[model samples]
Target: MGAEGGLRERKKLQTRAALADAALRLALEKGPDNVTVEEIAEAADVSVRTFFNYFPHKEHAILGRNPEHLERALDRMRTAPAEESPLTTMWFVVQDVLRDLESDGQLSRRGELIMSSPTLLYQLMMSSFDDERQLTAALAIRMGEPAGSVRTALIVSAAGAACRVAMDLHKNAPDRPVVELVREGFQLLAHGIDPAFDQRGIS
Candidate 1:
């Protein structure tokens, strides 16, 4: 019975992802303004009602507003070794999340769409603020700090900023692996900004 329940949940998630992917693909080919919910449903081979069940509207579908991924990241954080530093655990969680996203191939397409559409990019940035809040809360819980503590907030904010910078670098250098860029971004955080500055003139 438990296995059956889990399988059913997985099917639901797959269906939701399919719908979102279809919407994104269509939006990429034809502008978001021209893509309708019905067309998205048709592309995904699901009924319009099913599409609505997964997303409130076309915009949400295009943005892929699923919180399950974030929840899974939090679960990874919770399971990380107690002795690991919060930054280390959080970075590991980010890598896991990005690896899964990169494997899906949808992330690169979404980045392209976001870059091409000013409105979509603005909406994505707004949605990221919500993601940051959720991540900050999860990190605080893992560190045993109060949900809204300053330390957690600052750490999460810094991490978020680092990721944004890494993503921008990835956008510019699509040939390079995003995870590698992300690691470099974190190294900047760990080693201090402009690590080469002191030796620049001497060499």
Candidate 2:
């Protein structure tokens, strides 16, 4: 892209991020239901019309439309070695994503804000469901199986569960490295989630 085009793209990304940050902050301070798109746009120093150019609605702004981690995970799935299982590939991908989230403190704050509001929480859940569906389809294509097949669905959902469990555990134990917790979760899945599975022996 040309210099002028690149500058415009950067400006757009900056504005979008500013809007999302404002939405999360305001929601945290005044409850999600109480927050309005006009308030959010004002917080970000943008007009209401400009906000619509970036996001369809307030919920979308709060969630943020970009799913960088999902995109990266899909790319890893595509390039993973032929012998690697889908679960194994996702184990690393989840940890990598979690580490990134941890580095960006704002993400933890976003999670807190989302959890505080039922509306935001439900929207986030639906968004995650859609992400899982996309990943399931990608895995199916890679394995030459039907996207809706039970086997593919189980694999994707199980992996997603492990990641969620790890995040929950980390939330309860703030002193622990989330990536380490994520590995333990994946280790359980690797061993059939067996009661007798030795998690420490996996790595």
Candidate 3:
């Protein structure tokens, strides 16, 4: 039963990813306002009912990050070494997330789609805020600080900036290694963005 359940869950994830990929590609190809849930379902070779099963609406599918990926990131953040600083932990998390997204080869396309639509961009930002809140709470527990503390927000903001820069760099230079760019961004953040600092590596 457990094995069967695991298989079922994997199938659900695959279907959700297919719907999202279809919605994103269609949105980019034919503007977000031009896309329809029926068309998205057809593109994914699923019924409109199946599309609704995974996403509440067309916009959600276009702007959605995979739930499996988000859960994996949160789990990694929670299980990261206690001795590591929050920034260091987040650096590793960002690297892992980027690597996983790269394996599927959709991160750049998703970014482009989001940027092209104001509504989608707003939805994505709202989703990100929820994620940030959860991440901040997790880190605050580790540091024995309030989740609302300025120090906690600052750390999260720095890590988030590095992530955004890494993603933007990847979108511009698809051939370059994202992990390397991420390392450089984080190293700069860790060292107060000193242009003169040795950035041979991040430690």
- What are the lDDT figures for the candidates, one per model? 0.79, 0.77, 0.78
Where does candidate 2 stray beyond 4 Å? 65-69, 96-100, 166-172, 176-180, 195-203
Cα lDDT tens digits for candidate 1, 1-203: 99999999999989987888888889988998899999999999999999888887888889777767678767877787889877787687677767666766877667666666777767767777787788788878888899779988877677767766666666788886767777887887777787667785688
Please, what is the TM-score per model?
Answer: 0.82, 0.79, 0.82
Give the lDDT ranking, best first.
Answer: 1, 3, 2
TM-score of candidate 3 versus the correct structure, residues matched by position: 0.82
Summarize candidate 2's per-residue lDDT along 1-203 as a digit string, tens digits: 69999999889878987898888788778888888999999999999999999887898788665566789988987888889988887777776666665553665566555655678767867877898888888888888897578887788888777755655665667676656776777787777776776879978
lDDT (C-alpha) at residue 188 in model 3: 80
Question: For residues 1-203, could you state the per-residue lDDT of candidate 3 as single tens digits?
Answer: 99999999999988987888888788888999999999999999999999988887898898656665567767877788878888888877777667766666777777656665688877767777777777777777777897588887778767777666665677678676656777888888887876777767865
Best by lDDT: 1
